[model samples]
Target: MTINHRAEAERHLSKASFMTGDGPNATPVNPAAADHYLRMAQVHATLATGQALVADASAYRAALASWRDIVAHFVAWGLSFAENDDEHGTYLRLAQRLDEAGLNIDNDIDKITPEFGKDPRGMWKPPTVRRAEWAAECAATNPPF
Candidate 1:
């Protein structure tokens, strides 16, 4: 059975919009909801990329914009969270990756480390493990979108 990754991407994007309170007088941005949508977007983007590798130009074209938007939203959300969370290195790593991909993240990297330095708690106890585990899990699974 062939998967329609484009449709899946749209579905995720819709969910993301709703999560961000795009509709009339809706609830404010829910962090958990935004994270959920961001993950869904990533899964669909990966699926679309896989399809494109097999010469599925339609899937690639359809998902490209959604993927870009998803990344943008994810970055924005993460940066907002990171602004206060002294122990969250995940956002900085995410920002670096996005920057490396030429996404032009406006958040300054220099600010992240200084924020951590100022905070008494500093970095997370087991730095990098949780983020690595999450990334691995995401890479391994293609959830039903």
Candidate 2:
């Protein structure tokens, strides 16, 4: 008549794991206890991935222009105030993101301040402009025939 505490603990641990749906495709051993935080992680994993990247790569990146516009609108439209030294780093990072996204800023001095500058060059353009530019380039090149 021997008692095994470790075996009993292991059994309980396994039962808890299954009840909480702890692993991928794990069938709930105790369906009554299926509601747990572990499922939140699985649901977020499906939802939080970058779904905005489904289109053509250029268009996907170009679509970031709308985000840039929103930033600019806030920077210009917000309440008037000067910048603080401590918050300069955040503005610097924001400025760098605009530059990294192929947008050139005017009023370069304001970039270091909280306003993130006043002007943005090379902003969004319509697809028709791209088509016309492509047509011009194609005409400039000699025909293969």
Candidate 3:
């Protein structure tokens, strides 16, 4: 039997509620963790669709950027889950495919660093906190989609 990796990733992502709570009790889940899983689902879905469609270089590059963003989020949180998780093999496979396609994934990592800002204590704030602040700021300035 073949596994539908994209579907599996999406299932994992759905386990997190993001803005809303999950399950009967509606317990709030960690938004950062939710975002991490969502991004993981995105990475898998993008690769699945891109490969099926025979996507161009730009699409592959965008996927690489998204993957880098996930890594950056983990870095900001001071966590090594991205490097040590069970799905690490899947992540590396996708990365290798992009590399083989001539997409420089390292370039995306350089761009992701500036999005994280330092906290009052002079340490880099967690990605969850930064993402919430950014979302609030954007909502205040721009209309919701």
Q: Name the best candidate (by lDDT).
A: 1
Ranking by lDDT: 1, 3, 2
Q: Per-residue alpha-carbon lDDT of model 1 for 1-145, expressed as tens digits?
A: 8888867887887888777565567768777888898788889888988877878677787798677666655544454444444434566577567779886544333334344343222333223554576677897896657
lDDT of 3 by residue, 34-119 (tens): 88778878877876776557557778889877876776554433321233333444444554566797754544434444455434
For candidate 3, give the lDDT of residue 20.
53
Off-target runs (Cα >4 Å) in candidate 1 are 20-24, 56-145
| Among all candidates shown, the one with the greatest TM-score | 1
Q: Put down candidate 2 lDDT per residue, 39-109, tens digits, no spaces.
A: 54344444433322433566867777666666655443331121442243354455567778777443433
User: What RMSD does each model have against the real structure?
Assistant: 27.6, 20.0, 27.6
Model 1 lDDT, full chain set: 0.62
lDDT winner, 1 or 3: 1
lDDT per model, in order?
0.62, 0.46, 0.57
What's model 2's TM-score? 0.25
